[model samples]
Target chain A: MSNGQETSQETFAALEALKEHYSLPSLTFSVPRQVQGLVLPVVIAVVWEALAQTGILPANWLPAPSVVVATLLELLRGGELLGHIGVTLARVVSGFLIGALAATLLGGVTGSSPLVRRVLDPTLQALRSIPSMAWVPLFLLWLGIHESSKIALIAVGVFFPVYLNLLSGILTVDRKLLEVGQVFRLDRVQQVRRVILPAALPSYLVGLRSGLGLGWMFVVAAEIMGASRGLGFLMIDGQMTGRASVIIASIVLFALFGKLTDLVLERAAKGLLGQRGIEF
Target chain B: MGLAGAHRAALDIRGLCKDFAVHGGRVTALQDINLTVRQGDFISIIGSSGCGKSTLLRIIAGLETDYQGDAEFEGERINGPGLERGVVFQEHRLFPWLTVRENVAFGLGGGRENSRGESVREHIDLVGLTGFEQAYPHQLSGGMAQRAAIARALVNRPQVLLLDEPFGALDALTKIQMQEEVLRIWRAEGATMVLVTHDIDEAVFLGDRVVIMSNRPGTIKRIIPVDLPRPRDRGSYEFTHLRSAIYAEFFRQEDKPFAYAI
Candidate 1:
């Protein structure tokens, strides 16, 4: 055992020495990272310029990337894009918050108790099956063609996924862990806080990510239905005015926002659970 | 070590019978089982698979209350799980979301809020997991997680610690090490322990008396006293002899068809 330990120590030392000998320049940089971020957009702009110059497609149908950028810059300066974007973002955030909170609380209750699970399960399942768009007309009827209708649609869209995921996560908590809690005589609240809540978090986070994405989708769909403001309304307005550039710009912005939101969610999840190193 | 003047046994099993209704028919898991465990008794139950050793332990733990017989602790009938009887299952079953400290603290009772943090810390230290208190179950190795489970069970200071193949999932080296650790902890805590395992050698090593059971619809075949001193030598002639003797009894029960049939 002593000899084996010495050999392993020598092997580790050799590996470290090799790593130091062949070390490459560190890619770590403050400014270079920002430049790297611009690479994709710059490449796309160059490609668009080349295609427009070649006239491979009709100019009106496929406007140069510069033209789209100019249109976006003009819209921003006039406060049109900003106002719509702000409205759309506010709706999404409020709707998603309401849905996520309600789902989490209800999911926790149903997951811990069999009777509650039995009572609520079938109804939730029925509600979940109804498409988010299908609820737009009904919500409009109930709350009128207003912000409440859009928010309601988005909230319903977000609720089902979060609720199902959280409930399953709670239900699947290892019985052994519960036994451990029982042995200690942990009260119901402590058990929920210490065992049930934490155990259900990973699954809950997954649900949150998907729920937010769906919320974004439902918000756009709701805005398109009747709203006179927001990004989705802007797209519909652009369509009516035949401003292809504005339509394309709004779509691009929505995609970018979605990507950014996903990235932020991923980072948040990693920060919360990275140390524990839960694989799933 | 003395059984005298301890009132009645810490746990007493009388005419214990457990049956499970399977798809085929009613399968008897335990039949006419009787045992008495004095305070601080370390009893190991060993048998082949389906011999219902674990069923007996579960019954005593009050986890399985549907059994036909009675389990009494200090003259009171055993009911559902309580702080007095703690069970450690085969899997560690530590809550994945909870840190080691939190998991241990959970066993200290949720209603007793004021001093929980202190008690949880004490149990974590008792299990030698003081530094890893903030580490979640997913962060710990299998052996360490099992230790956390043990710590959780011990947090309630149960009168009896029932272990059902607690070390069965561990590697061989870890299993032996855990056996010793359990022996040391048992001595220190002076809690009555009932360990159920399929390994004869393990039963002989940890048990004051190894209880061998017959096959399905299980009943005790025999009780063999282990006279080895503390820190028992596994390689000693007496130890090996007793191990082989218990192994032989297990095989002998296997050879007899329906030895414990209803």
Candidate 2:
């Protein structure tokens, strides 16, 4: 009878341990997470509007949020705002895709092979040290002041972050995991496809995000140099014509679109990594 | 001989010596080790830390080949890792990106998509992890993750399975449970297993024979055969007798003063 009781206790303890292991604390929020994030921004916007209404600041230098909104509406009604946004979005997307593809191929090669890393890393590092504006003049001369030069400038900006992050990711893959690949008798291609690539994916996604950010920054610089249309052109045109509200509207659009694209990339990355339960 | 044919021994190791190159000087890790594991036998190798028992197992698994030795499996020269011998590490080492199902399927390699899916499911069921097929490694308890690791190792249907302290990380209760599970699996699969561990009770409980090891240029000190019947009781007199006998070997080593070579 005593032995039976002890066995039952032991089984109960084991079951309790297992239950504890499986139970991860769920996070519950009264207010939605996105709404909580917006509280501070909303407060700042209200304060700024109040200050503008009191007439302490001049209208030409720092336009009110309302004034910027009106200017944006006027541009929208004229049907030119959408065209500028579309053209700017196209340049950024095209440049980002090209840069990411080339970086992934090169990063994979250098990350996996020591010989390739030794041969190419130094030259790439030197190229990365050159400023983004420095490439503008060279690219303009080489590809001419058109869509190609602008796209090339954006690609160079996108290249370094993606390449560096991916290379570091591959290099830092756990040695024990590599040993698992070896013990399983995985050949070179099999090792890359199954072990190294999957291990480096989280870092690769991170690189893509930062690379897209740099692509946006470079597009602005590209359009400022020479372009007939785009948000950057709108900003330049506003500056020349001394329209503070228009300049502010263009800046606001840049912020909105940049954040929108990042959220989209983040959503896609979450879908890819949802099963693994990795945090963004 | 092929795996299907009869063999003299599952693993044959003789005059095995290994060295490590540390800061330009060579440090001997294992020296003149000799052991022959019979087919369907469970051999437990016990040693203190840095005893090089793990190095010996790695050599047999073909993960470490830079050594002077004759390590053969079923009369074939072991040059590199092959599918015939599977290894389970201390850490589960499940790819975090892969689900339980996909991680097990990885053992069958990336080809023959349709045929191997059945085998992957079979191994997952064998480990009693059928319902949690889509779960990631972090979602599992330590014991469950290790079970998945064992399933992945056995998915290839290897004749020999090498375990490097496979249950060393589990809690006491879970460790006992996993030991019983392993013994049951050994009987079911009839695969020759070599388990390297530091636990005396564990070595006595699971092994058909226990090989004692000594450190500082590691070598096999003794090989004690266990004649206990199946489901051996831990509290039995015979069990304690064998456990103390192995403990005596380590106690004897402690009597001598520490010797340093510098």
Candidate 3:
């Protein structure tokens, strides 16, 4: 029994060694994951600031990280940055909601019915091919160069990905599951609500995230073309006045806000699906 | 036939024909199929691959509509799928988003009142999945998921339960265990079951009559009654004899050209 115990102990130790060898490397210092993610960004900012301080890199054309931060702080102090951010946020939110709603309706119609798919899918595919910038002039002429045109441009950008993803998502719902719906004698509406929508949810969530990313992109384009206010306007104003720090600050804010919004969407998707591996 | 014929028919199919369109031409899947399933009878359909055994089950389930001839349930024409006939597919087909309880409850549909007042809990317990009510489908083993699917089919108290190769995916041990579980549920529920399988032993073990079929332009070749008492011993001579009888039918046609052989 003692000899058996010794052999078992040796086997256990070997198993432990094998596990350690195969396991992903854990951090030695036990730093939180969120803080760990910040390390690279902090390192880059410090290096850029040091280079500027040493006069190795010129600050006028490409502002130092600290100068951009200082400029952002100045804008915050004047309360102008908040207004610009609010305007941009409102535009993106409205455009995203509109685009998502329209896509859901049309995607449902075309995805479920082959007849509608044959009638509309080709035309939608053609419309999707035209570049985002091409829509800017048409949107301006149709909706005017105000918030409407900007939102419209973002809506058009947001529409395609969501629509396409939802369409394919609905189209590809497992025929087996639909057969279950049929066997259970679920009506047409019940089939849509109970089977198709839930099965297609993961893909739909993917579309929403991509649509949101595109919404951010188109909002930038919309603002840059001609905006009285917004981060895009701030960038243009800074460039015209030769304030490179302010321009860099606006760019930084856009990056920050875009990432934050996407994070919100991802969190919502996670909460809705609960631990399923979302492809996006 | 005398024993099964004594009971009133739960499902009656006559002159059933099914065709599928291939690249250039139509291929016959099922041809001149005729069968009668009596009340509370367990019918197992055995065939080789491409025998259209599943196609027959689908036609009875009302999932296939373009078939020729009549399939009636309890003297009513099966124009489409109805609540009275529940089907369990090879895969569990549980909605991934719903829990086991939710998936079973879905058989009740959104707002349709359960007139019998039978609870989903009863069906879950019937399939021996009582403790797993809150579990997701992916968390369960193949046999366990299949059990949940059986529970979902039974929850509505369907008069005719159709199983299409339900245990075809399971390992040997799990398959045997699931077969026993199905037998128990069938006895308890008293629903007429038509199970499609390629396993001859499975057909002998559970079926009241095994309906053997010929391949490609599939047709019913014979229906042999299993008069053996339960619970059946798979090792018994009578059991092996029944199983081998079904096996001999498949190989008997080996020398003939398969499509034209029918």
Candidate 3: give the TM-score of chain A. 0.87
Per-prediction tally of clashes: 4, 0, 0
| Residue A231 lDDT in candidate 3 | 90
lDDT tens readout by residue for model 1, A1-280: 2235568999999999999799887795545755888877888889888898799756677778888889999999997888999999999889999999999989989988889999998899988887768877788899999899899889888898899999999988777666666656567887787777877788999999999999899988998888899999988988898887888888888898878887888889888777666553
**What's the lDDT for candidate 2?**
0.90
Candidate 3 residues B121-144, lDDT tens each? 899888898888778876777788
Between candidates 1 and 3, which one is better according to lDDT? 3
- What is the Cα-based lDDT of residue B241 in candidate 2? 99
C-alpha displacement of A129 in model 3, angstroms? 2.9
* Candidate 3 local distance difference test against the native: 0.89
In TM-score terms, candidate 1 sits at 0.86
* Candidate 3 true-interface contact recovery: 0.61
Chain A TM-score by candidate, in order: 0.82, 0.87, 0.87
> How well does each candidate superpose onto the true structure, as a TM-score?
0.86, 0.91, 0.88
Model 2 Cα lDDT, one tens digit per residue, A1-280: 2235568999999999999799778585456866899878888888888888888778888877898899999999999999999999999999999999899999999998899999999999998898878988888899998899998888888988999999999999999999889888888888888899888988999999999999999999898878989999999999999998889999999999999999999999999887676888
- Over the stretch A58-136, how does candidate 3's per-residue lDDT look in tens digits? 8887778878888989999999999999999999999999998999889989987889999999999999999979988
lDDT of each: 0.83, 0.90, 0.89
Question: What is the fnat of candidate 2?
Answer: 0.71
Better of 2 and 3 by DockQ: 2
- Score residue B149 of candidate 2 by CA lDDT: 96
| TM-score-best of 1 and 2 | 2
lDDT of 2 by residue, B1-262 (tens): 4555434588999999999999999999999999999888899999998999999999999988898978888888788898889999999999888888878887777764722487788888888899988899878888999999999999988999999999988889999999998998888788999999999999999999999999988999999999999799999999999999999898787676345311
Cα shift from native, residue B226, model 1 (Å): 0.7
Clashing residue pairs found in predicted model 1: A184-B107, A185-B109, A186-B110, A187-B110
